[model samples]
Target chain A: MFEKLDPLLHSQLRLAVMSLLVGVKEAEFNYIKEKTGATAGNLSVQLNKLKDADYISITKEIVGSYPRTTCKVLPKGRKAFSEYVNALSSYIHPNGNE
Target chain B: MNDAQKQLEMIHEMMNKSQREFQSASFYYLFWGWLVFISALVHYLLLTQTNFTHPYAVWATMPIAGIISGIYAAKQQKSSKVKTYIDEAIGSLWLIVAFAFFGLIAMAPALGIDKVYPFLILLYGIGTATTGKITGFKLLYISGLLTFPLAVASAYMNFDNQLLVLALAIFISYIIPGHLLKKKELQMANSDA
Candidate 1:
């Protein structure tokens, strides 16, 4: 009776990341990590999953001597986020459909 | 029901607790608020009390303010990794205001300096009110809207008196709203920690 929540955003850490990026123009990997409280390795894996799905685009660049990774939510990601929210709302509300 | 509810709860909390969202918004308002206030006061004093040929020269301080703003922006960029929609909207709004400020200044000679404060106050009203409305900060919106009347009042006043009106406008619009925003930011940060 309910649409499926986008599995890519269904997880805690990834949803946290998308929630942040969904509002911002873009965010650095470290910033997302700090906010999500996800270990670098775990966040990297999840981020890559999102990237592969074209939900987000990650750019790695050398700023000064260090590399900076910035992630942006593409149109698909934003659409997916809204869909996820709507699906979740309906799923949780139960009687909303009626 | 259970899992979906948990997920929804998480989304709500994360959005609320987003680290340091628009943290420095208050600082700029406060800084520019006082700066304009002081400049306008000095402008009045010079025009009224002193024999200084160029009362307008006091505005030279803006270049220094510009430098400070640039440095502040760079520091903010360095410290912050996320740029929220509010940040983007406020940033673009002020950028446009900056250009319009210059445009008005360029036209000042044609309009006469006495006539310029009304337009400048109008600009101030636009920047603050728009920023407030978009961000849903009530202090900014109400204070910003209050400046419109001041702008109109300044239009009727003489040159030296216009400076006083301008000073009042800055106090209400920028100084008050900036401080309020700053206080709210600190409170939110404290709650987060």
Candidate 2:
């Protein structure tokens, strides 16, 4: 009687991104990179996967002379994250104990 | 532990990592507080003590302060990594305040400098209290709301004395709170480190 975790968010790096994003309205690409401790190239690839699933929205704009990219979690992504957490909890504490 | 347990722990770690402490926005309060404090005092001296015909010229510093504030804010925006809902709300509130401030200054000639002090005090209360409430900083909101009566009292006083009232209000609402906020930031940073 275990529900399945959202496979899209089950991976460590992707899950890390979602968890961090759920805590903020929006964060810069560089900020996420620094927080997640993932290489830029790998983070970009993972971010695209989440973006393709409508899990997050990315914005690119020129601030002063630099092109800054920002990412925000969408409602669908938040819901999936919540569900994933529930599934994990259920698996960890089947009888509702530690 | 199982895979599920490992994932759960990772989630907890990531969430904790992203949970941030509040940014110290004490800079705005301190900068504006000192600016208003000095300007009001200078205005009072020029009006009462000096035979200066253009005592009101002291307030021409507003545009310069505005330019400095704009540049500072732009730099803060550029350096900020995460944008929280609180920041967004405070940003919008200050934007409105800026517009209202310039509007009041433009109308000062028509309203008379005597009339402008009270309105400026009212604006300060509105901005401070709203910001305090939004940021969940009790000292800020309390001092901010306390300025309302000060504004009303300033309206009844003469122009020279009104400057004193304005300085007092700025002292309580902005300068004191600004320093306390900065102190809190330092303490938090120390604890975090």
Candidate 3:
């Protein structure tokens, strides 16, 4: 039997954001946009969704008179991402142990 | 492929891409490496070539250069759009090393200046090796490994000879690796452009 993937992370863009965040301490809004090739509006919406879910934390601060938005994956988010990956692996390789 | 398999691939791809895109400002390494190199050489010269009795005074360069480097690093970090886990880890590691240096300096009077170089070299070794492990850079790992024996050798040498060993260790462990890192950063920046 396959485990259910987290709906929050099932989307292409959301998963991509989580994947990027998983490797970094924190990333700026522009950095994530560049990496994901997603529109700023779309990325902001997805990021907000993750932030609301407590899967990530978003901080807005001024850097050299410019407002910068940085996102970091929370422990909850890391755990969820790992579980999601495990579920995906289980589905892909049913005979293999997670 | 099924959706699950596709998602798995996507995750892997995104992570790999993010890792690849990561770039550090190589200026800091270059700045400190040269500063230390010059300082050590000048210190050695003052101790041997000149009538200068205060060879230790040359170490004043470290604090001055450190202040400048700290300011530059802050500016760079402020401007940077992303900070990686590796960056944070390396930053923390160096912070610890810096404190250790300070602690060693305070204890130098009791431990004697001659005994300090070996411990300082060992700290350099630890810092460089851990940095290599974190970045998966082999040159830095090898440089770090080389410092261990140099540190041991320094223990058996006189102060003047130990200065030369420190100079050689810094050249191998910091300057060379620093230049390579700068080259890598430039290549990454150019490729991005």
Candidate 4:
């Protein structure tokens, strides 16, 4: 039997975002879009999904007359990501239990 | 391969990409390195050759350098979309160095100028070595490691020669590293373009 992966992080764009955030302090929305090659609407929607899951925090602030949306991985998100990786490894080496 | 394994591979790829982008912060290193190099060189020259009463007047360059660096940092921050943990850690480390420098300067009268260079060298070692470890840059690590002996050597020297040693230390630990960082940044930028 394989370990279960977190559905929230199993998607392509969301997983990409999480992977990026895991190593960074925080990142702006535009940066995520640039890195992931996701459309603004798609990235925004995916970010909302992760935010709703309590895996990430989204902050909106005005800087120099521009509204900036920055995203950071929460502790919960880090935990989930760790577990997800563990589960992934299990599947990758399921028969290596010898 | 199953879905989970595929996702894991994707995660690794994305993480690597982000890390690569974060390693291009050569401007800050170059700016401070050159500023300190020039300031220390001039300070040493003034002490040895000029009749200037306060050789310390040369340190006025620090605030001016700080102002230019501040403007550059703010502009970089405004333009940068990504902020990495490594970037934040290095930035915080330098900030602490700045405050510690001010503290040392304030206490210089009591500690005496002869004792100052050793401490400054030690601090440089710590700053550069840790930065090297964080960024996986080997040259920086070597530079940082060299400062330890240099600091110890400066401790036994007279004030004037101590100044010369300090300049030499800065050249190894900062100026060389700064230029290497700039070269790396340019290569990365060109590759990207």
Which is the leading candidate under DockQ? 3
What class would a CAPRI assessor give candidate 3's docking?
A: medium
Per-model TM-score versus the true fold? 0.89, 0.82, 0.93, 0.91
Q: Residue-wise lDDT of candidate 1 within B6-48, one digit each (tens)?
A: 8878887777755337647877888999999999999999999
User: Where does model 1 exceed 4 Å of error?
Assistant: A62-66, A93-98
> CAPRI band of model 4?
medium
**Model-by-model DockQ, in order:** 0.64, 0.66, 0.78, 0.72
The C-alpha stretches of model 4 lying farther than 4 A from their native spots are A95-98
Give each model's clash number: 0, 0, 1, 0
- The C-alpha lDDT values of all candidates are 0.87, 0.89, 0.87, 0.86
- What C-alpha RMSD separates each model from the true structure? 2.4, 3.5, 1.8, 2.1
Candidate 3's residue-wise lDDT over A1-98, tens digit each?
87888999989999999999998888999999998999999999999999999999999998768899999999999999999998889888888855
Candidate 1 clashing pairs?
none
lDDT (Cα, tens digit) per residue for candidate 2, span B40-59: 99999999998999987987
lDDT of 1 by residue, A1-98 (tens): 78887878988888988887887778889888888889999999999999999999999987767888999999999999999998998987767854
Fnat of every candidate, listed in order: 0.73, 0.82, 0.86, 0.79
Evaluation by DockQ, superior candidate among 2 and 3: 3
Put down candidate 4 lDDT per residue, B1-193, tens digits, no spaces.
Answer: 4777678878998898788666456676677777777778788889899999898887888898899888988888876778887888888998998888888888889999888878887888889988898888999989999999999999999888887877888888888998898888888879866
Tens-place lDDT per residue, model 3, B59-82, is 887888889978988987888888
Query: What fraction of native interface contacts does model 2 preserve?
Result: 0.82
